[model samples]
Target chain A: MLDQAFETLKTYDWGTDRNLLNPIDEAIVASQADPAARRGLEGRLVAVLKTDVTRAAKDFVCRALMILGTADSVPALAALLAEPEQSHMARYALERITAPEAAQAMRDALPKLDGQMKIGVIGSLGARRDVASVPALAALLGDTDTAIARSAALALGAIGTPAAAKALMRTKPTSAEAASAVTDAALDCAEGLLAAGKSVEALAVYKRFAGEDQPKHVRLAATRGMLACAGK
Target chain B: MNPSTRKISRRRFLEGSAAGISAFSIVPRHVLGMGQTPPSEELGGALIGCGGQGPGTVGGMGSGIRMIAFCDVDRRRVENAAKRFGAKDVYTDFRKLLERPDIDVVAIATHPGWHPLTSIAAMEAGKDVLCEKPMSRFIAEGRAVVEAAKRYGRIFQIGTYGRFNASRDPKQILIHKIMASGLLKECQAVHIKRGGLKVAEWSGMVRYEVSDPGDREWDLYCGPAPLRPFHAHRFGGTHRGYWDYEGGGLADMAQHHFDPINWVYAKDATSPVQVEASAPPAHPEACGMWGWVELRYADGLTFVMDSDEWGDRYDRQTERDVRLEDLSPIDQQKIREMPDPEPLVGFAEAVKTRQQPGGHAEAAHRTATLMHLANIAIRTGRKITYDPKKEQILGDAEANRLVNQPMRAPWRVV
Candidate 1:
């Protein structure tokens, strides 16, 4: 049944009855308790990805990998990260895989891609909250493209490490978009720092924007953060 | 006249004149020329997602609201709604609409995916919000919305009034008092909401052809959610069917059912400590039918949501209401002596007075978290042990990932 399902999935496309792939679904459920079974299934799914399958078929495989894929599946998924049609789903799987190599794959792809693809990979790195990628993401904070720069700032903010916070604080925004993203990222960093029990560091982040020079709402958020850090 | 003395006299004269006009007018004030509300009294309102429940939500805000702007990813929806509501401004992007200084209140009737982002942006722009429910796509987004409301000091009300009605019910008030008094250490009550979840109706179509998104900013419509090929089912009310945008009918209807339950159980401030579900493996992109989900709070309160759309109904626990007998005699007497909880302020009043509404951000987030947790349990096909204070899934990295799912590029909730 599993072999037949793989054959059916090889030709799968939109508008096809998904129930035809029920065998794969059953395998996923059955493998939940067996780590060896999960790895075997992941290998089969990755094998299918290496084939010349339809985009929809690869999409299904990636979705399964999102649940079952480990480091062994990263290289196959990473190979698709630069392809426009497949990159989003590839990132979707890699973003959730709790493997350091997955984040590394995305970081490696960062400089090689541009436009939305690069932005997507940046987002994947941020979503993974990869501390190692902070320096790389911080480098793009000064990118000429407003969207890339804004995404970089927000990604650093998502990372919310003291290093990421320092990176955001060092760069001056070139556009209003970047400015807003910076303030928002700073607030996020402050909140994250406060949550991690580094109140003094959180207070410094908060105090950066608590001045009258900032917008009223930003000032308000900063003041609130400062008060929280003060244990008020 | 001196400035202070003249100011007092002018206020008295204006008050007397207003009173005299009201005393003599036989016709309705709106019918008379006096019906035109002053600028200070009228709220400038904007509506996002002008299809589905958008117009109805704005219309419910009463006549004191002036519909000034309308925004939707679909141009047709925005234009049609703007024309219907006499709004002069329409936009395909909400960021532009949020820039309008005149918009005092924003009614967000977008899909669950856009709820948190739009609500947070609106609050940060200094506008009060009446956001459509299932207040968030996941637990972390809901928490972000709550923090944004507090940080910006904005009035936020999820579009559910069950809690307000529950607050007025005498029986519910007693239950609330008993549960909230902190005197009852262990609550053995069980709540079961059976059927009416539209589980089958909203089960996602796993097979659909890609369709053109005509006159719709497809990318913007997919904001925060994954950028998938445009399918008609992935748009409009049916968007509830997809896991990318929502958690099927459970997310669509659970807030309506659970908001009041949360209030009565005094569970608004926290979440369930354990959640388990019985269902077939869920599709990664599409939502599927589920048999039941059982959520247990740390204090022994169990909430069983039986879909009744799939297999036999959940029979593990019988319905048990909280009663005086559940408490000790001394606790019962103390409950009797306790005053009834205060009446909850509604959205409109909250906006006007700058007070928290009955379904405020924290309460709404907790209610929405129930649906997210249940869906997570169903998707993972496992029992989930959770830390409510930390809002993390214990020993399950994959389940914890679902709690704070990643957003697509340029859309960070943090």
Candidate 2:
């Protein structure tokens, strides 16, 4: 019955025949409340993803995996993150996968992806707060692709470890895009540090932004951030 | 048409029952394995707005049912969405889309100005509505839509999910403490986090040319907004920049950031008694950046929109509101015993069960009120007084004009 239900996946569309997809939809909803069923769904989805199928069919399976996916499903989803057609849906699942391995997958795929796909992977790293990807992400700071470098700067801020903060601070932003992304991230890093109660570390990041030479908005943010840190 | 007084035919309730019969084809909830018996019927939804945040809002509701109809002024957008979402019915007018009796739910993700009017119309047509935020462009209009939803007994949700999608943010926890502890009588600037100011202003800053204004349905697109020649900037993403259609960023971000404050204060049934802003003078035709604004409830609780400048100390105020060291054991235990915020139940589930979604109409309206009031305060450059019960701007003639704006020919906010 479960196998039969998975077969309906091939014809699934966003706003399509509900009665046709009921059994499969039930399984997806049911899996959310039961751990065993979640793992079972994950296993079956991974298997289905591995099979040769229409890209749309695979996209359907990936959506289900967003709620039920485990580390076992990450590799299959990761492989699709660079394929232009499937990359968006793949990244959507991986971004919410809640597994470290999903973060690792994006990091591993970074070198091979380009344009939006590459930028999407870098962004997923930041969203996941993959601290371990900081060094690799830092390298993209100097990349000729301004969008890629900006994505890296923001990702490092999201990672928000002292090391990530240091990397962002060390880089001399070359373009307007890079500068904006770095400033946004710097504040985020300072915020992350302050939230963790490492006021000294937070202040260190804020100080770089507080100088008169800094842009007015960044300077204003840094000055306020410094007060927030000192108060703590 | 005075939208406030527009009557729903008794036939709609009859249609509601008729809709019930065909609605059972919904995805069976039994699959989720919760203890409750699963409904065999699925809810069918329709999209009334096909541009900007419309698609994403529909997408985020997750898949349980399908939206069979798609509507937009832009034919290209409507058709593209129809292909992408498997929508069978497409139209340029929402009234035409509402003719589908099979549509059990409607997602009105149109511009902010249209939220109240579209939602009221959908409810009158016996459809549950999930409207995008800034429930109305003005306070009085929002109140009318809320009344319409109540009168029609329709399930209505606003697009902002911040209040419902509660998480364990430290600031939220502290705010909850202040609420549960009843220490808010003297509270001022007692809540704060990234408000009103982005460190780096991010805008498209792209020059928008109409390309060929006559080629698009410009008149219909401007529905209820003042009659004006089409400018691409006045369309999609840049609509927030103009006061003719929306209240700018404050209105746009109101539900996202202010809903929790409303939830804590239970401010839905009422609104701020006073709204004051210290921003530079605002533009008559467009919106600009605002400085800090204070939304003061009748009870002395002030919701401060913090500025970027240093020494605002809004965070310090929140900290001072509840320090664990300062609290007695009994008080601390009271804080501890206060229940954690429940996770937001899904909207699809809410529709199946005939209950409210996390971002229900009342809360969304009250939160949206804050943004509208701020805009009024900034525009008038004075501390404006508001009477929540009257739903009117108090004693300020010019400000009151904005409280209930007159729509152009062939449209009314009633």
Candidate 3:
């Protein structure tokens, strides 16, 4: 039954009947309780990626891996991370995979990709809260492309470490878009710090923006953060 | 008349005319005072996602609000809504609309995927929000929206009003009091919400051709969700069918039913400890039909949602209502002496008084969590053991990951 489903998947494309993939779906559900069954299913799914399947077929497999894939499946998924048509779907699966190697694969792809592809990889890194990639992400804060720089700033904010906060505080944005991203990211770091019980550190981050020169809304957020840090 | 006295009277008349004109302009009521806004003092308002529900949400805000802006990913929707509301400002991007300081209130009827980001951004910009329900796309996003409301001192109300109606019911108030008193250590009550979940109606289209989203910012519309090829089914109201944007009909309609149930059961502050569902394995992208879901709270209360749209009916728990008999005799006596719960504040009143609304952020988050947890169970095809306090799934890393699903980058909830 699984072989028949895989054969159907190989020809699957947009506008094709999805019911043809039902056997695979049934297997995924049936294998949830049996670890051996799950690993077996994962192996079969990963094997399909190495073949010349349709984009829709690969998309379906990646979605399944999001729920069932383990470290053993990472290499096949990571291989697609630099392919423009496949990268987002690959990240969709890798972002949810809890294995450290999945994140490493994404960070490794950063230098090989650019444009929206690079931005997408940066996003996956941030989504994983990959602290190891912070310095690499911080370096992109000054990239000439505003969108890439903005994404990097937001990614750093999503990481929300003290180091991420310091990187944001030390840099001045050359573009309005990046400046807004920086403010949003700094606030995100402070909120994260406060939630982690580092009130003094959070206060320092907030105080950086709580000045008359800042926008009214920014000042308001900073004031709120300061008051929260003081336990008011 | 003397020349000097006549000139002074003319100046006074001009000042009074200016005040009358200003009364019709957009000034937030809170800035005026804590008192009810005068009939003439119109609050500035904006509508996001100006599709089928956006204009309706704006109209529902009562005549005290003057529509100032209309925003939608689709230019056609934005243009249509702007013309209908006589709004001079229209934008395809919500971020630009949110920047207007004069927009005292924002009515968000966007897809659930955009709910948390738009709500949080609006709150941070110092505008009160009336967001459409189910309050978030995921559990963590809902909690973030709640925190932003508190952090920024903003008023937030989910679109559903069932809890307001429940708060007005005398019997419901009694059940609320009994449950909230926490004296009933063992609750054996069973509450069931049957049928009308629209499971089949909202089940997603599994196969559709990618099409152009004419005049729509397709990437912006995807927002925190993965950027997928644009298909008509994935746009507008039909967007409810996809997990990428929403949790299907259950998410589309659950809040209306669960909001009041959560209020009466005093489950607004916590969540069910275990959830099991009867359904086919859900499609990873498109939502599918589900038979039923049984959620159990730690206190022995069972809340069952039977989607009469599929399979066998859920008959494990007899249909019944909470009774005084469900509580211990001592606890019953204590509840009888307790006062009725306070009447819930309406959104408009809450916005004026700076008080929490009936369907405030925390309660909305809890209600939305019930739907999310049920969907999680259906998708995983397993019984989920959850920790209500920590908001994590026990002994299951994959299931726990659903509780705080990662948003696509540049859109972190934390």
Candidate 4:
């Protein structure tokens, strides 16, 4: 019956029935307690993806993988990263998988991909908060693609480390768009620093934002951040 | 993205639903999704107050769950929020909002005083409630809300997540560390310090200048409260500084601070036995800032909130302190493993499963009552006794009057 549900994903029409989601959700919850069941479900999903599948079909498979995917599932998802249509869904799944191998898969895909696909991998790496990827992410800050640079900045911000903060500063762009993204990421990094109780470092980040050139909101936030720092 | 997706899921959900889900069967079939619909299954709802907390609160519920109707006394707020959230139906009257049969839930984002009217109405209409906290303006209204929730068997969640999750607020983190260290077990009373630089203000003055005061449907906004001309401060921002709409800063921020404290101490099932306050005489129409207040339980555990010192202190009545090493290993382990609470995430989970959210109605009511009673003591300038079993203020006429405050028209406490 569960396999039938998995099969439905392959054959189901796009707008036909939402009830198709029921069995999928049921399987996800059921897999949580049963290791054998989880293994079976992951295998079924990965196996289905191996077939010539529709984008929507792969999307369903990726959604399921997000719930129950493991190290074994990373390679199949990584293969989809170069396919623009599937890259988004693949990252959606890969980013959430707790397995460090998913992070490795994303990091490995970095040098081989470009455009949005490369950016997606950068994001997944950040989502994974793989500290080891900092240097690689740092290098992307110098990339000519402003969007790419922005994404890399945003990803490093998501990673939120003193090292990430320093990388952002070292590679701080003069372009307004890239600078804005970097500063946004810096604010996030500062927040993370505060959360982890690196107050001095956080205050320094806030001080950077307190610069006269920064926009009003960022400056106001930086001012508030300094007050918070002083209060602590 | 698909209409058939919604229809099929709704039908499937009904078909899969168990014949009955008793109140005692707290783990409803919906949660397991084994024979039920998934979180991805769309359940529509309405936003009752669109101006303040409504939009953000609804946003946190995710894009999948749609708000079909929007209600607010202010026409501008309604039109703006409806357009912003893509809500097709808009009404100034919340009762009209409740009349919609399609709304599976109603997010009551009005001021705390109006909470009772909207929440009870929604629950009675078979809609689950997501209410902003200070669950009720008064103790009586809170009791009514809890009763309505039980009678209607609807999931009622107060919007405060302090009881449900770890907070990012510095003050909350301070409280969290204290709880994690096993310092919550009380010998007797507590004394709070006035940590924040700015003291709470209870100014009811409509200081800000506004061009169009007539834009709001003033009577609808007032609801059961005393009707008056719409002022910027009266209905919208800083309304918590007023007595008619809310119970000042303590009441406004009460659940945020106390809900988690109530949970950590297992005090959700009951209320304080007595409350006393030290403050300047409260104005008849405006809530005033309070100085020091004490809440004493029947078990002789006491809590004193001091605006002077600004930090929590266990009253050195009996035990000086029990360090981490002094406590039993079980409690220590429990503290160490105390689970992080998810707020909106849990609400979505509960909606799918029909279980109680972490910050459910009963706990909210208890915490609100704890805060409200302090306000009651401060206002009346007397120590007030409460019978938690009877759910009433005992032997104090003014305090009782405050709890069972009169309503003007078109609404009555259930």
Q: Which candidate number maximizes lDDT?
A: 1
Q: Please give, for residues A58-175, the per-residue lDDT of candidate 4 as tens digits.
A: 8768766765688889999999988877787777667667678888888889999898678767766764567889999999998998878887887788677899988887775958
Q: Which pairs of residues clash in candidate 2, taking residues 3 or more apart in a chain or in different chains?
A: A29-B32, A30-B31, A30-B32, B2-B414, B3-B414, B4-B414, B24-B41, B25-B42, B26-B41, B26-B42
DockQ of 2: 0.01
Please identify model 4 stretches exceeding 4 Å from their true place: A1-232, B1-40, B166-199, B204-212, B309-345
- What residue pairs clash in candidate 4, if any at all? B30-B353, B31-B353, B193-B309, B193-B310, B193-B311, B194-B309, B194-B310, B195-B310
RMSD of each: 9.0, 26.0, 10.2, 25.6
lDDT of 2 by residue, A1-232 (tens): 6667677766544334324544664666444346788687788888878877767567667656664666888999988977776786687578667668888888889889888778777876775668789999999998888888988887787677888888888999899657766776776677667666677998888888788887543554565566666662
DockQ winner, 1 or 4: 1
**Candidate numbers sorted by TM-score from highest down:** 1, 3, 2, 4
Candidate 1 lDDT, A96-164, residue by residue in tens: 888899999999999998887788888788766789999999999999999899888888987888899
Model 3 per-residue lDDT tens digits across residues A65-141: 88888998899999988787787778778888999999998888888888877888887787677899999999999
Worst 10 residues of 2 chain A by lDDT: A13-22
lDDT of candidate 2 over B1-414, digit per residue (tens): 112111122122223442443254344456666553334455677888899888887865645667789998888888998888876689988877876778888888888777877887677566878888768898767875665554344677877776654444666665656555664454443455455543113121223233456555787777756444466777886787777678766776756788876776556557889888776545445666666677778866677776564234344234224344445677667777777756555567667665556676766777888888888887777789998766678786446656765343223334
Local distance difference test scores for all models: 0.83, 0.68, 0.82, 0.68
- The weakest ten consecutive residues by lDDT in model 3 chain A span A223-232
Where model 1 places Cα greater than 4 Å from the true spot, the runs are: B1-37, B60-63
Estimate, for each residue in B317-342, the C-alpha lDDT of model 4 and write its tens digit: 33222234434687656655655433
Quote the positional error of residue B23 for candidate 3 in Å. 24
Model 3: residue B380 alpha-carbon error in angstroms: 1.6
Per-candidate TM-score, chain A: 0.94, 0.89, 0.96, 0.87
lDDT at position B190, candidate 1: 95
Number of residue pairs clashing in candidate 2, backbone atoms closer than 3 angstroms, sequence gap of 3 or more or interchain: 10
Interface root mean square deviation of every model, in Å? 15.3, 25.3, 17.1, 28.2
